[model samples]
Target: KYVPIENAKYTLTERFVDEEGNEISPSVVKGTDYEEGSEYDVTGDAKVIDGYYLKETSNTTGKFGKGDMTATFTYAKLGKIIPVDPEGNPIPDAPTPQYPNNPTDPGKTTPDQPVPEIPGYRPEVPSVTPTDPGKDTPVKYVPIENAKYTLTERFVDEEGNEISPSVVKGTDYEEGSEYDVTGDAKVIDGYYLKETSNTTGKFGKGDMTATFTYAKLGKIIPVDPEGNPIPDAPTPQYPNDPTDPGKTTPDQPVPEIPGYRPEVPSVTPTDPGKDTPVKYVPIENAKYTLTE
Candidate 1:
């Protein structure tokens, strides 16, 4: 609940902390009351500290009744007063929003144009490696190799109203199955363990929650602009190219190093918790110990 202060003004002052815990001072603004005890949901640009604005929900609360929120501002002994309005979203009137004019071209007053779609959603194969003639574009995107992820566990719904462990595997989603993700159930995996809910109970039998096992499935090779996979892509059978002209070779046999991992030619997880990953194991009478 909020109690508005008309005729009188409210303001709060505080120092700012940098991401590294350093304190910044000198430039500052104050916040006033929209009213006390009033619940409000929020949107708009994230609050900024040290030139960075906070985006997204830092927290959430209900809106006070049904009226739209407002803003009002007074200049500190340092500057000018800013008027009020819902600047694209609902924020209170007391804590006026201040935007520092773009300093790179502060003298020129025109605005920047907009490019509606991002590269991922653009038409054509967005350059695998940037070839931008303009200074604004990056030169190229470094391709990270041997990057791999494994499946782990699943968290699903409970049967009806009971709380028991009976969940399905995330492999279900890998093969393109319709599953739940909201409230009623969850689908957890190793590489990306999640415990979300699906209100409609789309995972499985009404109420069943359980721990899931994990395994390596496969890797993704970055495809080239000419419909071919990039030569250095981490796909099976494409390793050790001395010439560098890129070859589409056949799958190489697992090397004779008895217990070395011959399963995946691509990179595998190096950390499985507190222990360092063992790269190879020595075979002995069919049993082996991974090199410690």
Candidate 2:
């Protein structure tokens, strides 16, 4: 008497290999197997087969009744093929596989390798190099085409000594953008600020430079009773004076004039210079006695 065993069921899965030979799990079920023999035959199919070729067909188990079988069908992708120019020749380099011998098989090859760089010819697709086959792989060769410029500030004290901690060391600006420089120079005691150069207009293609200069305050001079500055005066002593060079001699009282009595007793001068003449109105208007 011969006993018939129940037919075992086998599952076939399809995987794709990309141009770089990276393995990619595709959502495809080739078929199911229900054969009664120890050794079973299996076949697979793909809805889309563009840029791909059947590389291998294998199974986890050769005997059907031993265990559940997984038949894996791997497809290798053709190299991305593109032309260097409109004429369609001289293709760019193909994606290099991370593992030479056992390249991970991704599902499909790149659409086309970027065209080799040629004078006056630009590729429609940007050139990108595939990283090692894995989740969240970083992309290579990002392009930067925007123009950039730099703004620099220089500060100096009245003695030409560089001030500590520059106001604005350097700043970056896009081309054609404006940079404000009105407040670049800082105020210092006993010194006046003078801006020599600044970036007020739209930024240009090249780097920008700003400059500032400071001047010391001028000395204050004192005037004497004669309205003339004391000659050969020394620098004024700070916060003190009995003989402070900035001090002036006390004014002498004006002598009494007989014909014209002065209306004011004395005049004081704040600044050193020639004395200002005093104007006096006649005390009494003369009628010449009208008789003579």
Best candidate according to lDDT: 2
Against the reference, the lDDT scores of all candidates come to 0.29, 0.45
Give the clash count for model 2. 12
Model 2, residue 230: C-alpha shift (Å): 4.4
Q: How accurate locally is residue 5 in candidate 1, as Cα lDDT from 0 to 100?
A: 45
lDDT (10s digit) by residue, model 1, range 29-99? 33455344455443321233323322223223333332323321111111111222223221122222223
Model 2 Cα lDDT, one tens digit per residue, 68-169: 455555666444323343444443332333211122233333432343432223455554333321212212322234555567776666466766345544
Worst 10 residues of 1 by lDDT: 72-81
Clashes of 1: 36
Candidate 1 TM-score, true structure as reference: 0.16
The TM-score of candidate 2 is 0.28
